[model samples]
Target: MNDDEKTRDYNKAVAAFAKRYLPYKQPLLKTIENFSPELADVVIRHGLYEIWEEMTPLLSYRDKEIATLAALITDNTVMKEITAHTENCLIQGMSKKEVLEILTVLTLYIGVPKIINVMDAVKQAFENYDQHIKNKG
Candidate 1:
């Protein structure tokens, strides 16, 4: 395919993928775009097009959310992302028990103190999910 066609196809694929799997992020992306348009483009193109699109087909969506949540839990930075992915874990069909279990597993590797921080982030996610999404339906 020509360069223009390739770009078009890539964008189309990103749109479809983001719509289904990444809708939780649209508000965050829009907020970032409002302050930094170029960074927003890079986040969208790199994350959706390059990262998620490539990785998602290799795992079920639920598995992908688990993996992402685990990574965010371990990194111990990016509190907001940790919260977002924790919520996404539920949106992807994980029960609250399953989500909490991730913390139990991570405690073995990350130690109790760090896991404490992760626990609070997860608590916020759970509260948000319960209040906003879980009982609505």
Candidate 2:
């Protein structure tokens, strides 16, 4: 495909993926798109659509989410991503109990300081998810 065609295809793919997996993050996505449309396309197509979409028998979506959450804590990423992934974890059938267990284990490896940040994000994610369900009903 030509440059324009490739950009269009990537944009389309990003939109479809976001609609399915990132419906609640429109404002953040739009901000990135506004700052640098090309960067937004790269992020959506590569990060969310490609790597996140892979779910093999060896690494199911739930496992991937758990891993992602733990890695995010270790890397000290933005709170919004942590919150978003926490929501995705619940959507993928990860119980709150399991999330707690994972976080507890991660504290040893990622340290208490990082877990502090992660816990706040986790709390926000739960609150947001609860509110979202309430609004839907």
- TM-scores for the candidates: 0.78, 0.78
Model 1: weakest 10-residue lDDT segment is 16-25
Alpha-carbon RMSD of each model: 3.1, 2.9
Over the stretch 1-137, how does candidate 1's per-residue lDDT look in tens digits? 57686567457645745544435555665586688866755666556565666655878767877888888778899898888888878878899999888888888998888888877888988888787664566
CA-lDDT, candidates in order:
0.74, 0.74
Candidate 2's C-alpha runs over 4 A off are 1-16, 19-22, 54-58
The lDDT, on a scale of 0 to 1, for candidate 1 is: 0.74
The alpha-carbon deviation from the true structure for residue 6 of candidate 2, after best TM-score superposition, in angstroms, is 3.5
Candidate 2 residue 62 C-alpha distance from true site, Å: 2.2
Q: Write the per-residue lDDT of candidate 2 for residues 1-137, one digit (tens) a residue.
A: 47786566566656655544445776676787889978976776556645655323477777878888878768887887788888878877888888888888988887888888778889988887788768878
Deviation in angstroms for 8 in model 2?
6.5
